[model samples]
Target: MEALGWFLFAYQVFVLYYFAVLNFLYTTFTFFGLNMVARYARELSELSLKDLLEREAYLPVSILVPTYNEEKTIAASVRSFLALRYPEFEVIVVADGPKDRTLEVLKEAFALVEVDWVYRRALPTKPIRAVYRSLAHPNLLVVDKENGGKADALNAGLNFARYPLFCAVDADSLLDPEALLRASRLFLEDERVLAVGGTIRPLNGARVRGGVVEELRLPRGFLEKMQIIEYARAFFLGRAGWSAMDALLIISGAFGIFRREEALRVGGYRTDTVGEDMELVVRLHRKAREAGRDYRVLYTPDPICYTEVPSDWATLRRQRNRWHRGLWEVLLAHRAMLFNPRYGRLGFVALPYFLFFEALGPVVEVLGYALL
Candidate 1:
């Protein structure tokens, strides 16, 4: 009984230390992130944007949308992409054999016409049934393919992408007009920049017109309101914080731009993992480190993408569950980068932070609740 009591005491102490350390690290990151934001805003100005526009110092981009059963939002989302303010870009929407009227909706909405063209199969993916191009929008192209997961669909889109850079956008999300313009600038400014992740805001209760969030209003759902708070902390705080250290891991799948060559060199997205976005980022880090290359996967606060958050209990639970599992999958996959000095800050600082705090923190919290 005494030994059991001592063990319980130790566990309680550990939990206390865990929370303390976690909060302290987050606080430090908050300050670093704030400094980064201030410096970035001061350094980058409208004149720079105008200079890029005039000099054409921008890399042309291909926007890849990997979707399944997103029929309701596909049309509007495409409209928003077509309206983006960028010099040169194409929107490639890959329909991964949706069971709904996603294909039909896209066909009618975009006036999609089937055409045949040979392309390089840079990565293996499920078969592509047909390719459609919109007569109305020359830049809009749709790939109808067999049911593959989101990652596989992205790989398929990568195969069809024609630009040196590609931006991955979720079918249900809408980007700010200057999103591509702002994000693509990073690639042009720095050759070492591999990927740039944009901020994603919850779109519930926001008025929409032509796929743009016209007005912001608080939603009636309690969960939605809470998610707004959570999203803010996760992105603005956690992401920005890690980014300041050059250790930002996850560039959300909802919206992230990547250099096409580097992604293909890394073999594109891993289809088996649900956490494809995070895994790809980690892998990119690993590859860059191994090759002794100076590379950056960045998170910028400006370019924003608005997405729908789950409104109900069941959906929210499922999403959280998936995210938790995906985090585990990524950590396990890159176990080599956990603490090895070769990975530098990524191994010693970033990966350990994720393993101890983000991934295992919840498990410890739950166990603490049960024991106490």
Candidate 2:
């Protein structure tokens, strides 16, 4: 009994140490994130943005939206993309064989007509059924493809993307007018930046008209309203900190831009995992570091993409489960990088953080509760 008591006391000390280290790291990140965000905001002012446009330095971008059973939100989302302030961009909506009326609604809303599009398949994806061109918006193209997951749909879109840069977005989300311009500017300013992640806000309470969010408001549901706060904290602090350090491992799947050639060189999104976004980003970091190439993956708060949050408990639970599982999968897949000097900060610091604090957070929480 005495030995067991000593063991318990030691375990308690370890837990306390773990908790302190985690909070200290979070605090440091928060400070770094705030500074980075402030700098980004100043650089993204109206004059700077206008000058960027006038200089014609921005690269053309292809927006790849993967749709699945999204009949209600598909049209509005596409319209929002159409109204972005970027100089040159094409909206490619890949309908991932939805069981709902997603295809029909897109066709009717955009006056889509089947077109003969011939392009090289740079990446292997599920078979595509047909391609459509919209009469209403010349820049919009819709591809009806076989039933594939989000990553697969993105792969299909990647196969036909013509631009040098590609932005991946969810079909149910709405982007701010300047979202693309803000996100794409990083790539233009620095040749080393391979990818940039943008901020995503909850769209549950926003008023939408003509594909634009007219007003930003708190969501009606308690859960969704809480999520808004959670998202703000994560993006404003967590991602910003990582970006400032140039060790950001994950760019969100909801909205992020990537250099086309770099993404293709890394084999696009991995279709096998739920955490494809993080996996792709990690692979990018690994590949770049392994090649001895000077490169950066960034995150900025200026680009805002609003997406609807799951209000009900069941849906939210499933979402959280998927996220946790994905985090574990990514960490396991890249376990070789942990504590390795070769990957620098990514291996020595970031990977370990995700492995312990994030991947095993739930277990720690459970243990703490049980101890109490």
Candidate 3:
């Protein structure tokens, strides 16, 4: 028993040291990335919005929203997307056989009328019941599909999407009016930029008017507050850091834009994993690199998407569990990239960091607590 205790103590010490080192590295990388983003934003903001609008430089985008039993927030969420400021875009809402009145509310609110839309199945998904286009909003389309997971719903949307650029957003998330504009700019400015991820802010305490977040304020709930801090650190530091290194791994599912052709060429979103967002991003990188193409997957700070974090402990834990599990799934799915030199920075740095810290860090911490 005494020997076992010592063993555990030693493990705890090692894990703590590992955690400290990882945090330090991340902090350093974050600082560097923040500086880069500051410089980039400054240069970008100098450009005339009128010039961008006039040139029609922005690519048309298809906003894919997947919802499951999200009746409470679905209407507001769709409205937010529809209100986004962009040159040309369409909103495809996928109702994943919600057990609630998700479809009913959508039909009634939008005055949806069934339409004959043709699409080729690029990725396998459950049977789609029907496709409806809103007479009220010409850009709004709804797909009634069997209960597929978020990934499947996204896949379904991809099939019906008719744009060069596609963005996947959660049904409960609210996008800032300029979110799409800022995110899509990367693709226009840099011909090589395949995807761009935007920052996700907590929507609980934010002031929303006309389906747009007018202002951002810290949420009153402790969980929401913690999440705000977490998101800030994750985006302002972690993701920005990775983006600077040209090795971003996970683009937030809440709001991310990708080239439709590239996403489809890579076989679209994986239905087997909950972390389909991360997996798809990784696959994009892999595919891009293998083709020896000078492609970039970037993270921009300005495009903000407000999403509701889990307010209760149970929901929070479940969400975290799902995220962790999804990370593990992606890691396993791309096990080839682990420590493989051919993938360059991604193989040496991002994959290892995620494996050690993001994937296994919790287990190490939990074990340390038990041991102590």
Candidate 4:
């Protein structure tokens, strides 16, 4: 009975220490993140942005929109991409064989005419049915292809993308007017940047007009309100902290830009994992490290993309479950890099943090609750 008492007491102490350390790290990250965000904000002035645009020294980007069954909002989403303030970019909308009238909607809305635009297939994807270009907007191109997942659709876009850089945007999301200019500026300023991740805010309560968010307001639903906080912590605190340390792992697939050549070199997006975005970023880090190349995967706060969050309980639960699964999927895939010195800080610091604090966090939390 005495030995049992000691075991119980030790378990309780372990749980306490676990939470204390987690909270402490969160606090530290908050400080680092706030400082980094402030520094970045000061660095990017309106005059500098105008000067950069005036000089025309920006790298052109191909914006890829992968759609599955987005018939309702496809038109608005594409319009927002076309309305971006960037100088040179093409919008590639891959219709990943949606069951609805997604193609018809695009054809009617944008006056899409089927074109036989020949392009090199750098990455293998499901066969493309036809390619269409918009009469209203010359820069818009749509690829109608077989039913493939989101990653497969992105790969198809990569196959036909012509620009030196590509920005992946979900079909349901909208980018701010200056989003492209700000994100692409990173690559232009730094030669070593392989990718740049931008901030994503929930569009649940925003007033959107002309495919742009005109007003930002608190969401009415409890789920959406909670999501706003979750996103703030994850991106503003977690991502910014990791980025300041040069160890950012997951870049949201909804809005991330990559150097096209580097993406192709790393074999594009992997279709096998639900966590394709995180996996692709991880692979990029692993490859760069192995090659002894100096590269930076960055996360910045200025550029923003607004995405529709789950409004209902069932949908919210499903989305969170999928995200959690994705986290574990990525951690397992790169298990070899957990503490190996070969990958340096990524292995030693970032991976371990994700493994111990993020991945195993829930399991430990549940155990802690039971013990308490």
Q: What's the TM-score of each model vs. the native?
A: 0.98, 0.98, 0.95, 0.97
Model 4 agreement with the true structure over 69-137: per-residue lDDT tens digits: 999999999999999999999999999999999999999999999999999898999999999999999
lDDT of each: 0.92, 0.93, 0.89, 0.93
Give Cα distance to truth, residue 320, candidate 3, Å.
0.2
**Per-residue C-alpha lDDT of model 1 across residues 27-123, encoded as one tens digit per residue:** 9888988787777789778898888899988889999999899888899999999999899999999999899999999999999999996889999
Task: Give, for candidate 2, the lowest lDDT window spanning 10 residues.
Answer: 363-372
Q: Quick one: RMSD of model 4?
A: 1.2
TM-score of 3: 0.95
Per lDDT, the best of the predicted structures is 4
Output the better candidate (1/4) by lDDT.
Answer: 4
Q: For residues 75-154, could you state the per-residue lDDT of candidate 2 as single tens digits?
A: 88999999999999999999999999999999999999999999889899889899999999999999999997999999
lDDT-superior candidate, 2 or 3: 2
Residue 347, model 1: Cα distance from true site in angstroms:
0.9
lDDT of 2: 0.93
What TM-score quantifies how close candidate 2 is to the native fold? 0.98
| Clashes per candidate, residues 3 or more apart or on different chains | 0, 0, 0, 0
List candidate 4 segments past 4 Å from native. Answer: 1-4
